[model samples]
Target chain A: MSDPIFTAENVKQHYLIRQGMFADPIVLRAVDGASFVLNRGRTLAVVGESGCGKSTLARMVTMIEDPTEGRMTIDGSEILPGAASRDAVLRSRVQIVFQDPYGSLNPRQTIGKTLMEPLLINRKDVPAQERERRAREMLDLVGLRPEYFDRYPHMFSGGQRQRIAVARALMLDPEVLVLDEPVSALDLSIQSQILNLLVDLQDRLGLAYLFISHDLSVVRHVANEVMVMYLGKPVEQGPKDAVFAAPRHPYTKALMSATPTADPSRRQERIKLSGELPSPMAVPPGCPFHPRCWRASDRCRKDMPTLEGDAHRFACFNPIEA
Target chain B: MTEITETPATATGPAHPSPLREFWQYFSDNRGAVAGLVVFAAFFLVAVFAPLIAPYPPHEQFRDHLLQPPFWQPGGTLQFPLGTDPLGRDMLSRLIFGARYSFFIGMVVVSIASFFGVVIGVIAGFAPSWLDTLIMRLMDIVLSFPSLLLALVLVAVLGPSLMNAMIAIAVVLQPHFVRLTRAAVLSERPKDYVTAAKVAGAKPGRLMFVTVLPNCLAPIIVQAALSFSSAILDAAALGFLGMGAQPPTPEWGTMLAESREFILRAWWVVTFPGLCILFAVLAINLMGDGLRDALDPKLKRS
Candidate 1:
């Protein structure tokens, strides 16, 4: 259970956005210090508000773009900056499933061609028939039928298209998959089906998953461990049960209360936090979430707090205990 | 095109129409496009069968028929229905043969312009900011010149002839396609499919030409159609300017050029050729409109 298949150490992705021709560029710290280790057959859900650098982190782990700073490794191979371009074997070890299934798969390509693309591009040594065979096998593994082999993506519904996207990610037999809001675009009924398909695939293959989502309910349903992020940095990290049961950070507690529960008879205290998330360009000087935190102290406003604690960890000067 | 794989292959479902069939369905809905198609089809057959259907050879001179009026005119004879040029060449036969030249010119010019334009544009779109800026600035320089004048200068340097004229037109027209393709590629480059391809380890060339290029094709196709008609117009303009197909080649514009002086005396000499160019260009423009309506999904009615 403790065997790790993927790891990232203090990963930071900063983008310099130019203001104008004469103005100096401001750096957007998209993913400012993300560290996590994923065990095989387990899922790590990263929950954050929109623009909290969730997708940026997914891009880093998937090796779509190298992190501006820090280290990432998949199946023990260290993913150095620009190494994905030079060393494809290391890149192919991890794949990504995107949020918009409609946008992720090539509209021009047929479903089988879409599935076969990873193999075609990476495993050129494999014969055409072999590639076709493996692709069809993957379609079945993703719970799609055999007849979908030649149809374009527009013909399928959102859930089916997402299944195709998942199938494409699995085509190369990657040890890890970065699911970037994989179910957010899907209908509520369809979401559970796709989630079940993902869980089944994970169980059968023992693949590690870095699931990114803003929806706390979906995270609770699929994740073994959860990391709550605010303003491009993780505010709290722990096992899903522990974090969901007792969120130590102010931001995490606010996020958790916003999630609706099924128990109609039970009265729930929805913690209404004030102030919207600050723009990443002008993040506050001290604690990033201090502006919205009810328990903010003068010390919290003066000095940035580092993530501190044991198995259950949070970054706050004056913290709440559960 | 098999049935969609995700759905169960039940024979009861409506069959997905072929893309061509669907395109035709949408295209035929535009009545003006269909009418254009009919007119263009008749014109195409005339061009294809010019040698067999034309009563007289395109260049054959009936010396007595010089500047003869059309068959409807008082002195006109049925032998030359649309009348003759100053050279006594049958206007009908010459117009028929001229269609062939126009078609040939349009095909060649569009092919040459689009091939180079798409290639360069995709490169520019995929290239880093510095290289992209450099390529676009160069395209801008080319586009800054009035197309016909630039083509005239190019043909002047290349020496006036049919092939050289086409080469000039293609060079002049290439910038439009390049701008179009680059715009399309820029929009498409950020799409998730392109990122997926990159994540799959597709090389840069494959990503540009194979993955990104296909998605950009709808706009390119519309541009190509529009460019097709313009190519003909430009070629005819060049021919009229004596920078394109030379005399006695039966080109419509050259026919107009040959009879420029005779226009006041013998209206048929210029009128027939002018009408031919107008109708040909008009029909193609209508077809291009239809293509745009069909290819752009946003324009499709619910």
Candidate 2:
């Protein structure tokens, strides 16, 4: 098989925040030791709660935040944080779509201007006529009429705005799209429409998607692979079907049980985990999920378990049997 | 056809009115702002055609008509309809000529201050390092002094003159633009659109000026209008203090200063000039308020 489109090796992003004048600074390990590989034409969903560092990982992939350690390679080219000198050409290969469609678009800019911005910035050689042609084509590809190009963002509904945002991201013809909860703010009906559109676009373009969302059901529909994160560490990762059907890690089981099922007949007893997410500044020793894991033992609290497996990998000493 | 149905839906569908027409609609709705617009237009026209409109040259004195009340008063003549100042210059003519000074000073000071302040603010807010710290600290030091006092001190040092007073006031006003723009840039810097712009391969300069600056303009514009009136007021204060527009000049503030002694006898001398200042400032302020309401999208009616 050919190489994956994107590869990250043990990426780590740490921030030192001073508590007070008299207190010592604490280190926030927002994304600590995360490694993953994403190939073309596949979706890798990073599932976690609000502060599990999923967004930070998206930032790393988009090169918005420089990792303190580790390395990332896009299309076999190494790129470093704060080193924009590396390759401007490689930078355009990856683009991100933010969560808030309203806030993600410049209100002052027309839809045509917003869509053409990436083309104008990245491809200076393209003529103005060609850029406009491509912008119209993108607008059509995203299910928006060509006339909508002249209107501003406020002229469109939430779902239509997100379609415009999607079109804008695709204007550069990027190979990888890092969608940061692209549909979380939309209505349920709108969410399904956008998801179907994304699937159709991915099939046509053969694009890789780094889908970051907290909704497990949404992930189940869109993702081929799943990586469960807790307190900035990946606890389990595997094919979506395998991981969802037979979860090895206790945290994954808890998460799966918490997801609401549409069919009442398939509804299972919900597993309620105790306590809130611990502060990333002071992560618990050993297994990060030990405080909340029902199967956590004295051994689980003494030594950290490393992720191990060929097709399915999980970081837990006591695994649930299939 | 789908296209035929879609066209009208897109045109009159949402609350997305054409920006220019929407601005006019909002502006015309406010009675005070409409009045202000009329007053400002009249003042602007008077300033532009001062030489043509004024019956006598601003400095030309009519010895017989000194302290003349007005055309409606017992001793007033139609030639000097508004009246004559203590210097015997036509009060109506000087007031017309004085509009030129007020408008010119306001525009010059605001333009210079806004340009420099916005440039510095965009840099400081976007860079966010030692440069940001240094620029903000300098702005803090400048802002520590009261605006009028700082202008007074600068005028004293620069040697008092109209041009010097304008320069002093611009110096006092530039920091406000810096603070305003910096605060705006700081808030807009972390917005998702800005990040999306960066990921789209926009360089820092383009992001700061094109993507971020346009979004920050509504507040800046409202501030500019409000500051225009303040600039005129500051210039008048300097003229009144004898630090701006020296003797023989018929600036409104200087006319008031010259007529203070005879105010009880000839009320028109100080009252007309004072009313000129009051009306001009009031009109501009009302227009500024209306602009603030019009530009904000949140305040728009669905």
Best candidate, DockQ: 2
Chain B TM-score, all predictions listed:
0.92, 0.92
Give the alpha carbon lDDT tens digit for every residue of A1-322 in model 2: 3348999999999999998888989999999898898889999999998999999999989888889999999888788666542456777788889999989999879999999998898788999999999999998898887778777777677888898899998988889999999999999978888898898899999899999999999999999999999899888989899999999999889998998888999869899999999999999999999999889999889899988897789999999996
| Model 1 error, position B149 (Å) | 1.8
| Docking verdict class for candidate 2 | medium
lDDT of candidate 1 over A52-125, digit per residue (tens): 99999998888887888998877677767788887768878899999998899898788988888888878889
* TM-score of chain A, every prediction, order shown: 0.98, 0.97
**What TM-score does each of the candidates earn?**
0.95, 0.96
Q: Which ranges in model 2 have alpha carbons more than 4 Å from their true place?
A: A1-3, A83-86, B1-18
* Clashing residue pairs, backbone N/CA/C < 3 A, model 1: A147-B5, A148-B5
lDDT string for model 1 (B61-171, tens) is: 989888889999999989898888888889899999999999999999999999999999999999999999999999999999999999999999999999999999999
**CA RMSD per model (angstroms):** 3.0, 2.5
